[model samples]
Target: MRCHPLLPAWRAAARCLGALALLGAAVVARGQGVGAGVGGEAEIAAVGAQVQQLARDSAGRAGLRDARIEVEVGQLDPRLKLAPCQRIEPYLPPGLPVWGRTRIGLKCTQGPKPWNVTLPVTVHVYARSLVTQAALAAGTTLAPEHFTEAEVDLAAAPGLPIGQPGLAVGRTLARPLAAGSALRAADLKARQFFAAGETVRVVAGGPGWQVVTEAEAMNPGLEGQTVRVRTESGRLLQGRPVGDRQVEVML
Candidate 1:
């Protein structure tokens, strides 16, 4: 029999959906097995709630009070049957930050068979921050018009987000960024006051005394960064870049 042109496509999609449903059922069955032994489903659910509260507390301690925090606790592995735990202690793994994707360790302290397991968790910390208004290329000097404020998940990426437009304005981008992407402090290039081999004024100030002298910069003088400069006497001194072609040296 002849079939409709779209019939095969529809059949293929139906088969995919059926396979997905079967896979979902298998996962549910496996999850049921996980809680069948020691603590059971109710205890497992309680543990997840406790872990979530712990995550929220950690975020608050990290000074994310104004930020919207969301936590997702993963299910335990179904393969290992848990023993009846008289006390299940949930703790943050040592040296693991509570931000981003992290794990919470659960140990059976007073059980016949002591068991330790970790549940994966995803932490979302959302805050209002500046983001690119349009796709920007590397070396593009940032301006107020180039950014817009949006709610961004800070834990999704490293580096702190630039909150004020003035903080990022006049800075060049270090790399290309997609439109609507969060603007981070690390995304801007270090402010270059003077390049290496350039002449700069070295300002030295002491109690009731100030000395200004010219020196040759041995390396690029970036804002807030220290650079070595050779004075007229050929003595090398470390100074921080303060302005264009200027370095500040402490007495």
Candidate 2:
């Protein structure tokens, strides 16, 4: 075979290009594998700190005065072989709250082989709330002396804790409350506005008309709660309590 005049030069250029490509691939492989100084635990810790900062930012915006925020990050997957990242950046996860149980995203944005992950994060937002000051019997209505306001971890509460001292002032306890116990929504029920089987006035009209009738309460119910009532003519209906002895039904 006859060789062209520029064949030798072309061969040299191709060989140089092939060597450079091989070197580039080797460098990327080294980075993707277990690079000595890169530690998964370290990355996890960095991600955790970032999550805590983000949680604190949320507390400030929420106007929750004197709130204490604590963040806990879960362990990373051991089977994940993430490339050693130059910068492990943190970002907020969509549709998740930063105050309670949530998740945070961490990514290697500037690394040779970029990667990302979602880790479980828990934020304990503590704030002041009212709690029982002494053991109270069930059915005992709350008074000013029943509880006092104190700082408590809202995240750990069984239900939403009473924030204002007056919120517990007139509600009756569902069960006996222990001294110094947090006051959750499950702990109390609103006082019965009217006695069961008692005759009460119900307004049964809406926008255009007003019809007043009498009803007998089948069970005790609180204001704003639905109660079963028997009409004067023996018709059964459900209505919302409007006052101490008033029920209102939608037309």
Candidate 3:
């Protein structure tokens, strides 16, 4: 396959995968003869290939080039019958990412009965990530020894898994996690820097300029989370918590 000059490596690879899927569909459709519905197995396999490629491309784009990826393509509903098609296209449904349990789209382009259906899919992305060494209860402040690194499926649950010791250390768990479970950002509690009605420093800065003021936090200021504040003049604004009782707003 030739790479497009305008496309990145992952995009070029995606194009190649799409072309291969089309070619595979054509070959299988021919074997089924003209005016016959594409074989369900063949169609499912094509969708599976596309989904696997998508997960790999996505991981590559995210700088996980060496990450191990596994894709599981599921069966279509038995109650539904397919249509005769000369061409079938597999696609990722918009807004539905290839993470964990998801679906792949299969549409008949040149079929006697135009039809589209979703095939169940599960994308498992395995990499070195932090996992609890033992069952920990909620509110446990994480320490270096609390968790250890292991190769686990990042998409086995929601939220991005924590890989670095610095990210997991000193953070409190929001919920109890079982031993050997992958630790994710969602598993940690949001750190509260300032409580509601507290006067917090607000810093707004732009190129070559910086402004600092104090405002009353309308809501609790949680680390890396947005907090609503009212300035001295009662001007309401939103900013992200950067530090203890500190908020930053980009102008």
Candidate 4:
């Protein structure tokens, strides 16, 4: 018979089947172990409590309310030694929708060795409101017409300690300012006016004169002449010596 060839083929088939069986058994055992470890309700609850405390602490620091929070628990692993607070998500309060998300993680001491755990969490806060107030008129107080827009500064609102300056909330003006509106400090036009005791170059018909005056004025002097100056009632005497600032006029 042809038994030689058939024997080798049978042995190969048997070896393959045995290897598959071992692999299957190992897979099943590993799955069961994981399921059992996760099934410990008491340990999961304890870990959940720790996560809740972390959430509370973070919310307090952020000036958020506890009621506006939601917490979810994940399976605890023996390898996990760190806080999983990052997994928590807080609920938003009424009259407010989700604005943004913030993540936080912490670590607690369980024993000598530390385990790295992560908590995937989310925090929800109220949507900011916008309110605008415009500057009051000189004689009139603030009225509805004074405000042009309404908005709030969201970043500064959160995490504010009590008695600290609260968030700056307001709206922006929509339209251009009315004509003839009262001028603010920023609106005033700066004019450079001549001051007393300042030196000024005087140009007349001839030579340029440099005049240092104790008073403020554009003194009438000739271009190319030097003048002796005397001040009477903030005015320069016309008939004076020739110099830079003052010029002598021939009478």
Q: Pick the candidate with the highest TM-score.
A: 3
> Whole-model Cα lDDT per candidate?
0.67, 0.63, 0.70, 0.31
Instruction: Output the TM-score of candidate 1.
Output: 0.63
**Consecutive 10-residue window with the lowest summed lDDT within model 4:** 160-169
lDDT of 1 by residue, 124-179 (tens): 66667788889999999988899887888766777657777777889999999999
Report the C-alpha displacement of residue 3, candidate 3, in angstroms. 31
Local lDDT at 206 for model 1: 78
**For candidate 2, lDDT tens digit of each residue in 1-251?**
11112222223322322232233233333345554422355554554565455545544555442555565655445567777666655566667553456555666777778987665656565666777788888988888887776766666744557666666777788888788777877887755789898888988987889999888999886855789999978999889887878898896
Angstrom error of the Cα, residue 183, model 4: value is: 27
The global Cα lDDT (0 to 1) of model 2 is: 0.63
lDDT of 4 by residue, 1-251 (tens): 00111122223322322232233222222333353342255544454455445544544544443222333333334453333222222222334312223222223234344333332323222212222244433334223444332222222233311111121112122233343232222222222232334344332343554344333234334323333334434556444434434333443
If the candidates were sorted by their lDDT against the true structure, best first, what order would they fall in? Answer: 3, 1, 2, 4
- Candidate 2 clashes between residue pairs 3 or more apart in a chain or in different chains: none
* Window of ten residues with lowest summed lDDT in model 3: 1-10
lDDT of 3: 0.70
Q: TM-score per candidate, in order? A: 0.63, 0.60, 0.76, 0.21
